[model samples]
Structure formats: structure tokens, C-alpha cells
Target: METITENQKVRAAKKLKKMFGHVDLRDTSLICPIRDVMAVASDKWSILIVLYLGYFPVLRFNELKKKVYGISNKVLSERLKHLEGDGYLKRTMYPEVPVRVEYKLTDFGHSYLQKLIELTEWAETHKNCVISNRTSYHGS
Candidate 1:
């Protein structure tokens, strides 16, 4: 990690202490809702899935699996189901000789994906600095 100077540490401590106010560390009731919302897209697979759907208007299950490498079927299925359940995606099943299913982002999901795109760009900008910080912190 980029080492924080004593001055920075003191300033951060003061800000955190003031922000805590009367709330105990164990009392996370206030931030729980926001945390819960963020938890949905807090994983690699979920973020990739969102990005994929954003780029492609629609995609098949197998195509998604292929694009997001190393993701197990079970995990992909769970992610899709959860995203769909959370109103982030639309699942369409076609009645055919066998069966066909497609997934696409809803309007709300598209909006979220746009935000994620911004986050991705920000990360790309800081990626080198973050890697350097990690390497120095680990001393490896």
C-alpha cells in the first residue's frame, strides 16, 4: 500500500471519529441498506455479466459462459438468477424443438451498467498505481 504519512493518518482518524458520532462499531444499521445494494454487483462474475449484457443487447447462456471464462455453470446460473430476481435482467425462453433462452439487461440494469462503466474507467486509470501499492505493501 502507498504508505500514509503521520499527518494523513491523524487527519483520517479525526474524520472517522467525528463521523462515527454516537454509533458503535457494531451498530451498522444505518449503512446496511446501501451495503446490501452494493453487495449484488460486488463480485467479478456479476460485474462481467453486467458489462457483457451492456455491450450485447442479448446473449445466450452458453455464450455468456464462454465470454466469462472459468465461471462454473452453477455459479453463472446463480448469478443470472439473482440478477434477474433483482430486476437487473430479462430472461426470455423460446418454445422450440429443444429450448432456447436469452438474457438481456432491463432499463434499470442498463443504467446501473452505465455507472459500472464509469467505475471501470476509473479503475483502469488507477490500476497501475494500485498494483504498485500492493507490490510495495507485500514487499515481494
Candidate 2:
């Protein structure tokens, strides 16, 4: 993988600060672009669901529930509904004997997937540093 430039790191830091600069531990408002994006993107199940959808072009509800692992039916259902409502997922219901349904990514979801891949890559590169930092913090 290609290396991330210093400029990109600085820009990301600035953006994160801007997103969280308000410093509210109790609640958040969707007042800024960064907050709006992070609000949904940083949710517990959102990234996992998006990743699974990215990996599989299309999947049924049961398949998603099984693949995500440890996600309850209720949580999975809620997350799917939330994601679909947010325009990240496209749900298609087929007129069949038993009524088949499938879920896939919308164009916006695909774009978000690309950003996630980049973030994952950045994490991989800095993983050792992160581990060292955690160890130092805990060991001291």
C-alpha cells in the first residue's frame, strides 16, 4: 500500500478536531459535516454492516445476521433499517412465493466503503504504535 503523506495526517487531525471541538460528552448535534458523517459512521454496527455489504455484493437479512457474528436479531434489524433509511443500503424485495429480500450498497455506500478501506489501511500502518502507546499507558 502507498504511504499516507504528512499533509494528509495534519488535515485529518484538523478535521477531527473541528468535528469534535465542541466537547460535549452528554449529547451531540448534527451541526457540522464532520459530526454528521462521524455520527453515523462511528456507530457500533454501521461500519461492520457496511463492510459486510461491501464484501458481498448482495445479501439476505439472515446471511447478514450470521456473518456479522454476535449481533442480535433485534440489533441487526434495527441497524439495517437505520442504514437503509440513511441511504447507505438498497433493499429489494422480490415477488416470490415466500417473498425474498436482498440488500446491497447504494452509490453513496460504495463511496463510504472506499473511505473505510483507507481508514483501515491507516490503522494497520499505525497499529504497532497504537499498541505501544496503550502498553505504556497501562504499564506506567
Candidate 3:
């Protein structure tokens, strides 16, 4: 892993401050946009859903359920609705004997997926180290 220099750390901190400096915890009416967005976008299921859609381009509800294993139908339905509401993905319904529905990422979703790819790659690269650290912490 590349080490972060003191200057880099300071710059990162400054950027975060710029983004969040206006946040007032005492004001209940003010919403933290970043937190609200991340609450849906950064969850494990949403990440998998986005990644899978990135790979497959489009998928049906059942297809997404299969790809994102262990997610309950209710949760999957809820996440899909949230993702669609956030403008990350789109849902299309077809008129037929039985309705056909498909899900696909929008341009915004693709942009977010690019960012997620970087995070996913970092996680993949460091997973073993993280597990080792977790074991060490627990063993101690």
C-alpha cells in the first residue's frame, strides 16, 4: 500500500472540512446530503446491486436477487426502489400477459459505479490483511 504523506492527509482533511464545515448538528432541519446519499448507496446490498448492474448492464428482479445472494425479496425490492428514486437506476415495465420489468443503471449510476470500482478494488486488494488484522484484534 502507498503511504499517505502528511501533506496529503492535511489536504484530505481540508477537503472534508470544506464539504462538511457548514453542517450544524444543533439544527434538526438541516440535512446532510452526503450522509443521506451514502446511507443508501454505500450499503453492502446496494454496492453489490450496482456492481452487478455494471457488469450485466440490465437485469430483472429475480436476476438481481440471484446475483446479489442472501438478500431477501423485501429488502431487494426496497433497495431497488431506493436506488431508482436516487436516480442511480431505472425501472422499465412492459405490457404483456404478465408484466415484464427490467433494471438498468443510468448515466449517474455508471459514474457512481466508477467510484465504487475503485473502492471495490481496494477492498479486494486488502481483504486478507483486513481479515488478519481482525483475527489479531480478536485473538488479543
TM-score of 1: 0.79
**Per-residue alpha-carbon lDDT of candidate 1 for residues 25-139, written as tens digits (9 for 90 to 100):** 6878976765787888668899999999999899999999999999999999999998999899999999986799999999989989989999999899889999999999999
- Looking at model 1, the pairs that clash are none
Please give the CA lDDT of all the candidate structures: 0.91, 0.87, 0.94
Off by over 4 Å in 2: 1-37
Residue 5, candidate 3: C-alpha displacement in angstroms: 1.4
In model 1, the Cα lDDT at residue 2 comes to: 53
On lDDT, the candidate that comes out on top is: 3
Which model, 1 or 2, shows the larger TM-score?
Answer: 1
Best by TM-score: 3
Any residue pairs clashing in model 3, and if so which? none
Give the per-residue lDDT digits (tens) of candidate 2, residues 1-140.
36889999999999988867776736544456656767777686888899999999999999998899899999888888878888899999999988999999999899999988898888998898889999999995
Scored against the true structure, residue 138 in model 2 reaches a CA lDDT of 100
Clashes of each: 0, 0, 0
Tens-digit lDDT string for candidate 3 (1-140): 56879999999999988876887867645666766999999999999999999999989999999999999999999999999999999999999768989999999999999999999899998899899999999995
- A best-first ranking of the candidates according to their TM-score comes to 3, 1, 2
Residue runs of model 1 more than 4 Å from their true location after superposition: 1-25
